[model samples]
Target chain A: MRNLTEEELRVVFEKLAKFIGKDIKALVEDSNENYCFRLQKDRVYYAREVVAAAATNIARHNLASLGICVGKFTHGGRFQVHITFVTYLARLAKYKVWLKPQSEMSFLYGNNVLKGGVARMTENTPKNQQVVVFNQSEIPLGFGVSARSSLEVQQASSTDLIVLNQADVGSYLRDEDHFVGCGL
Target chain B: MDGVEVDLGSLSCADVRPIFQEETKQELEERIRRSVEFLVHGLFTLPEQSSERKSQRELPEPFSVIPRAKPIPKEKPLTKWEQFAKIRGIRKRKRDKFAWDEGRAEFRPIHGYRSINDGSNQVILPHDPSLEPGESPFDLLKEGKRKRIASNRKNQERNKRSLSKNQLPTHALRADKRSSKSLERSAKIVSISNRSLGKHEEGKKSKQKLSSTKRSLKKSIIPNGVERERTFQAVNDVLKNF
Candidate 1:
């Protein structure tokens, strides 16, 4: 579980940063696992993917600050990749702009009521509602560059990602419909 | 008309009389059988139509529609099963008419009627719980996190669909007057983004500076100090110098 040399990790980060720069501010590879990279941003994104490889090809997984192992499934195949990331920024954006405001409309219909369990945070939400708050829960949406491609190194080809942020997502959502379910 | 001439010489009464009498007897028997069938099958019935026919014949000439009502044409008396069916049919038709009238009355447009969800004139904030009428449905909706999110998404989708309908090229929805301006504004913003990212490069470069200034202005407007520290410093410094 020795860390990859600074050079090796830098190459991977640079390659990945180019694809999802809007969502990922930076990423780090720690010395706790082989072939594992920690993706960093305002909030850690939950990385979920469908990956297929031979028993000898890969070893472990990690996402920035989250030590919890995300769920995984395997099929008898040589190559596959299905991934999902639940970012705190994304969750926060959803709560503030989409979910929290909806509570005011709860008395009207059966479907609008908020089941009491998961804590929520948002502006304009009433004081009585009791929401767990976070100061760094924001995602930059419209103001970023995004790209996905394969980068061929000397021995193996890895999928490269890059993202760049330029605009405030809050304003963009204001002009557009703010209430979207799931990750848009 | 001289009561239609009868050629008795060519037609023998011997053969004809027996045939007529036999037919009359058969018809009388059948009529009696039907009367018995109606009584035995069920009490409700058309009482002896033959008697009704006889009474009609006895009425003053002016009161009769047919002078010779073609003697009911020897119909076989209703079988017991048929008698029951006829009575049931009459009752069913009467019941149907009554039910139909009752149902139709409910749907009729009353002079000043209003519906609970009337979208007729303007946006009615759904009966607010804050109002005295009842705890608003919105409150029920607010109780569950999952339900609340689902409802908001549904509402947004409905609004989007309605907006699209209103902005249709030729036929706009007259009912969406309140939302038309806001929808148009947002539609323009969407068009700006969707404008093929490839068009008019020279314009984009010239407009780039304008956009950056707008971005800076937006950053300066953010209330959080951490977000706009540099802009706040510049503003404060200018204010202090003044």
Candidate 2:
């Protein structure tokens, strides 16, 4: 694992801020332990400083994964957050959407959440904002880009798309091969 | 007259007298007059050419009598290749300026403009067995030619640098002065503030200078909370503009 370059760091931070907003500071400056981001084979890992340092002893090709895999930088240099990053984002997400029980399975099946599927959403959530998706019991399922803001969602037709699904917990099984060294 | 001898080539006459002979000033002047008269008579008797205007006596070619004004210059020092050639007893042979090119079926200049081997005119290059699978011969040839041009340019730059180091210290100092420290610092700041921090800029020489300035500005592992605070501020700045 290596330290992210200034350019890569800015991209990662900006993408993270889109979902968590100002809480990126809390993510970096955790009170209990020091956490830092390390990059290995284009995948950015969030790990304790000691763990990141110790993992350096392993050869690059042999080492599959280290700490929690947050995201991977695409070949085009865009940062793409993975489904595994849901835990952290769910905790600090500024806006959230809760899916009704009947439509949760459809969302897990990689389909966009329609207006009728959304049980509730954070008030005043802006349009096209990144938001975490949760069930009625507050169990984080996935994350998506909001197609309509809270105000617009009230007026939107039932069949109209409310949230555009980006990544979901169902990817754990569907994309199992991709997450081989992603520390599960 | 019997003791005098004359060299027509030098226009000079030498008179020989006995060592014990004493002569008065009038006798000396009379002897010189007789010698001069004899010389002029001999000149008139030799030959004559008549032109429309006048008749003139033809004179024989004169022997050079005067010494040269300056000494002969020393030969220049031999170059390395010349010295080597001399040691090996190699004699240079002149080659013809033009060579027959079989492909063109005509004689062409061996070097310079429109040379036979310039490759620019080739529409189809022979396929090479060593080329990788799926690789186009045309693209490979182009890449190789580009690499050769780049290397040639690099070698030329190296030669120029060596030449400047050996012969143009004042010129090199003037170049340094032209890119003064304050000017360079301002340029660096401008480059850093430009879109993409001037990372996509073209100039190879100035790129090195810009990177050095960037390295100096980069913070080296600041204390944990301080860096977090700095990142927080940067995030705020981005969010404020967002």
Candidate 3:
């Protein structure tokens, strides 16, 4: 594993900031442990400093993975957040959308959340803003970008798209091969 | 009595101690006062030039007794021209500040303020055989001057960019914040508000999606083992709000 370059960190932070906003700072700087972001095979991993330092000793090719794989940098250098990072995003997300019981299955199936499925959402969530998707029980299922702001969502038709699916729990099964390759 | 050695140049006196074993403090003080008076008298005796009720005395250069406060300044690095001149064994000759202007028929400054070399002062231009039918030499001169100034400005800006690039990445990033902090904050807000967290929107050029606040995130990729403490401090700050 190696340190993320400035450009890579910027992309990662920008993606993370979309959901967590300023809480991205809390992820890097924690009171319990010295956490950091490392890049291994273009995969961004959030790990403790000691773990990252120790991982450096392992042969670059031999090392399968280090810490939690938050996301991976595409060949184009764009950072795509994986479902694995949903837990942290769920906790720290500034804007969140809750799905109804009937809509949870559709969201888990990797479908865009329809307006009818959105039971509630954080107030003042702007359109195209990244938001963590949660069930009515408050368990975060995934995260996506809002197709409409909270005010606009009310005006939108029931069939209109609310949250544009970016990543969901369904990816764990669908994209299992990719996750295994990343040692997630 | 032992002879007292006093150097007026350094304004220091040596051997001012009691010459006699029975000499009183008053006698020592009296001797010092006399030495100071002698120095003052010597200063007044210097050659003087009187003009308009003011007499200017030519005081002899005083020899310094103490070492310099700071070390001698280092020699400045030579420019490319200077280096080239050195290689060619070109001894610099001081040019006269004033030069005779043939056209003006008068002595003018060689540089700056109505200088002899200033082409703008010329009224009748030397006709060029290669000139276009309607092209004025004055306009050509002005254009050339403008191009020269523009190139110089471009080079200066390039030099500044390269200088900042050579600096440490962290320092360079910090340099951006040297501007007004509130202005930067508002600029960041505008960037974010442009298109949903500043993501490049459809039908919009990539150039339009400029996000400036991303730099505020953790700059360094590797943790320096102090993040935990920072987090603890952050937690404390949050708790303090309660």
TM-scores, one per candidate: 0.13, 0.49, 0.45
Runs of candidate 2 exceeding 4 Å displacement: B1-242
Q: Can you write out model 2's per-residue Cα lDDT over A23-76, one digit (the tens) per residue? A: 877887655988877788899998887787678667778889888999999999
Predict model 1's lDDT versus the native: 0.30
lDDT of 2 by residue, B127-181 (tens): 7899899998777766877898777665544344332312233223223233334
For TM-score, the strongest prediction is 2
Rank order by DockQ, top first?
3, 2, 1
Model 1 misplaced stretches (Cα beyond 4 Å): A1-25, A29-35, A38-66, A69-97, A103-184, B1-242
CA lDDT of each prediction against the hidden true structure:
0.30, 0.77, 0.74
Q: What is the lDDT of residue A68 in candidate 3?
A: 83
User: How would you encode candidate 1's per-residue C-alpha lDDT over B111-184 as one tens digit per residue?
Assistant: 22342222243333455545566565544444554565566665554454454423333232332443645555
Q: Give the docking tier of candidate 2.
A: incorrect
Clashing pairs in 2: none
| Better structure of 1 and 3 per lDDT | 3
